[model samples]
Target chain A: MTKVIAGASMSLDGFIAGPDETGFEHLFRWLGAGDVEVPTANPGHTLRMSAVDAEYLRDQWDNTGAIVVGRRLFDLTGGWGGAHPIGRPVVVVTHEAPTGWEDTPFTFVTDGVTSAIERAKALAGDRWVGVNGGTMARQCLEAGLLDTIGVDLVPVVFGKGVPLFGELANAPVLLGAPEVVVGSGVTHLRYDVLR
Target chain B: MTKVIAGASMSLDGFIAGPDETGFEHLFRWLGAGDVEVPTANPGHTLRMSAVDAEYLRDQWDNTGAIVVGRRLFDLTGGWGGAHPIGRPVVVVTHEAPTGWEDTPFTFVTDGVTSAIERAKALAGDRWVGVNGGTMARQCLEAGLLDTIGVDLVPVVFGKGVPLFGELANAPVLLGAPEVVVGSGVTHLRYDVLR
Candidate 1:
């Protein structure tokens, strides 16, 4: 079954992106660092992975079959320059589809997040439908369509910024015990959304 | 050498406590559950610790020799009923020392965070000087006196509340890669403060 999974690298203070939709370079510095052996449970054993950034990107891209993003992110990134990064079917949840981009790679769903997610699920088939952008992910979470949340928590604090979970209308969602993977400079946490 | 260490359990959205200084039962539900083996790095290895709450209380109390807390927290908790839970010397950073509390186990430091930390260090000797409450912790972080930060990140998210790191006067403090320990319902993260 296809699951709706969302992942983002956020600061220790919970800001996924800085104010004014700023780039996440500061929060994601650990990912670009070279490979380093991170300690785990077994005192005699260590797990080796690629650089933090590369591992996260490779895992998400490999596991995802489609992507859903918000209109603001679509505009901010200029629609991924007419080509989606992961080469997946991209659904943009917006009030109005952009003009003169019919040949582009993005599918704009203006109706609502539900319609966008439906389209994404259709495209995803048996793989995961990933959500990007805080607004779109929050919408999926609020609509109870998101099944998993993976956070790459970097060890930096943005005193203020765009909070990953903000302005939700439902009661707090309960999450199963998280699976934590300690990396070079980022700790990866995956949680299953409880119904 | 005495290290100034700060620890707090915060919501996924970065709130250390709820609004109006509300109780942390919601954010801390994981602590009450018992006897769960948390998975770690090694495939065959699992960490068996006490219940989340018990482990946190024990580790903090055992490792700490003295504590520094904000005046508001000191007042809110009624000075921990004239004695701190750790049974160590407590320094309360306030503008003026509370009357009649001089005879109590708490010490009110009107000078500043530095002075409070100094007094805590004197009492702590070679052990850890624990910083409690967000305001006092932020002050220690801003002063470059905090040597480590341990955060027990709960899976719950409060839409809004007292943020863990708020109103810092200095630039973002970089932290070393954290040691991640996944527990029953909480993920404990400890990071070294990069000088």
Candidate 2:
């Protein structure tokens, strides 16, 4: 089974980016360095992560088979910026076929959310397929395509910007209690997908 | 000249809290145990603490000079919770003085933003006077009461909640490029207050 993981770090005030939405400086700050451990056992700021926990994250990253992202995130990263950060297969979800870049090698799926997930699953042999992007993540979640969601909460409030799950077109999707870790006021949480 | 800063975090989906104004679990997660390592270079987070950051934050709970909050936040947090978090002076920017909690020790002065800033500044002394509540933080920014804003972002989108700032008031409060660190996909950045 391919596990679709959606993850992002937001500011304390509920903004992924400022009004301009130009750079990710604020987002990076809240997350600190991924090295900081997440304290899942307790609640509040005292949450801390140990060395063994860090290894678990590192392993997840290494094992992620394929990546699925929306046009928004794909455009923001400049089509993965020449060199794809994640070496595995990358599937970009866009209504229109993107132009300007043919140098890199990745699968660009234009057939909406359902098609993208199917393509990603096929591309992801044994490893899990990771879902990126706000809309695509929500779509996969609503469609019951995702298997897990990893959330890293950064600390800053843009006051307003794009949101994760807007009014669900369908009935609400319920995510279970997440495993939490606290460090530098940034909370790291992960939820296993239901169904 | 005292430099004021505002530190806030939000979800990429542009929501500070969940719908209906009821906060999500992520809200509690972002706060952590309140045991944060206040950046030495950026003392604003810990209100200018000396030790390894944690001590300064711990000390802030007791030694805070004064407290500043917005009208909405004052009503929400104040309405339910009788006593304010810190025992120091509290100045709220509202047309009316709240007579609700005579039991709790809080000074509800309704003079104006400028007067409140002056009064809070004088009392704050070496201790940092914390500004809270989204609306209040904005007013303080407009009134020039804030010295530094310590932002902490979380990774959940409420889609709808009280906005941190909006077109009602837009001011040019400059921010230094934040220092960045990453953990669990959450990036933490610290910006110097440049007024």
Candidate 3:
């Protein structure tokens, strides 16, 4: 079975992004905080992190066969310049698919999260379907389709900003004790969502 | 020199309490989740937890010589039924000091968190002074008076609730990588405030 996982690097105060989309430097400081290099799909772009974090990141990248993300993120990075860092097929959840970007690794779904997840699962097969944070993650979790939650918890307080899973419709969402991986500037916690 | 630390049992989503002040059972579940016995100030009150948690709790309680809390918490538990769990002097920060509580182990500070912390530090001598969550923690952090942050992070997400430190005035407050202690159902993280 293809596991559906939602993942994000969050501040200690539970914000993925600080107010007005600020504080990315603090949230993602671990990306360049160490000596071990973890390269993404983009040529010449690599993350220098601690050996512990490098290993964890490599494993996550290797296991993720496909991705489901919301439209906002798609536009934010200009669709990762057509290649996601995960180096996997991308399924984007959007109302209207963007123009002139066909015959590539990206698949835009016009319907809903359920359909997008279903398509991504088919694309992922036996590996895993990685969901981006914010809207995409919230929809998947609320719909009971998310299997695990991976939080790269950084040691910074953002006070107020975009939350991990914004305004969860059904919550008190309990999770099992996480498989913890302590890195240089981040503590990676992978928790299974309880049924 | 006495260290000032603010601590709380927080959800993974950064809530010190769930919506409507609910979900205490989940927040405090780790206290009763294991076999090792950890005794409180009250003779008859004992917590059962894994050896890991018991040792952590013991170290915390033993090192904390005094506590500072907001008036809200003082009234919430009726001043912990006259005896705090940590077996230390309690300083309550309020607008008006309540009457008839003069001879107890509690002190009321009418000025602010600064005065309350000063009193707690005096009472603590060479030991650590602990500050409670929410308003008290926020004030301490904003004023650059808190030295460390200790979070007993539980595996739960409350969609909306009282945050760990509500709306920090000066944010993007970076911290050192935490000293992580993994327990049965909780992860105790102690982080030093970066200058």
Q: Which candidate comes out best when scored by DockQ?
A: 3
- By TM-score, who's the top model here? 3
Instruction: Give the clashing residue pairs of candidate 1, or none.
Output: A31-A53
Residues A1-195, model 2: lDDT tens digits? 667788666554434455676326656554334455553212333212344445555566677788888878877777655545556767888778767656555678887888987888888877788887667777887787877777665544354565555554542243454565554435565766545
Could you tell me which 10 consecutive residues in candidate 2 chain A have the lowest summed lDDT?
Answer: A39-48
Candidate 3 clash pair list: none
Q: Kindly report which residue stretches of model 2 are placed more than 4 angstroms away from their true locations once superposed.
A: A7-21, A24-61, A71-85, A94-105, A108-111, A147-159, A164-195, B1-16, B24-60, B77-82, B98-104, B108-111, B142-144, B148-156, B165-195
Candidate 1: stretches off by over 4 Å: A21-23, A35-56, B35-57
Evaluated at residue A105, the lDDT of candidate 2 is 51
Ranking by lDDT: 3, 1, 2
- Candidate 1's error at B8, in angstroms? 0.4
TM-score of chain B of 1: 0.86
lDDT of 3: 0.93
User: Per-residue lDDT of A1-195 in model 1, one digit per residue for the tens?
Assistant: 999988888888888976666547676666546665443223554434456545656676778889999988888878766666677878999888878888666898989999999999998898899998788778888999989988888888767778887766864666777877777668888888889
Residue by residue across B1-195, what tens digits does model 1's lDDT show?
A: 889999888887788976666538766666555665544223454444456545665666778889999989888878766677567888889998868876666888899999999999999988899998888888889989999998988887666788887856764667888877677678888899888
Best by lDDT: 3
What does the lDDT come to for candidate 1? 0.79
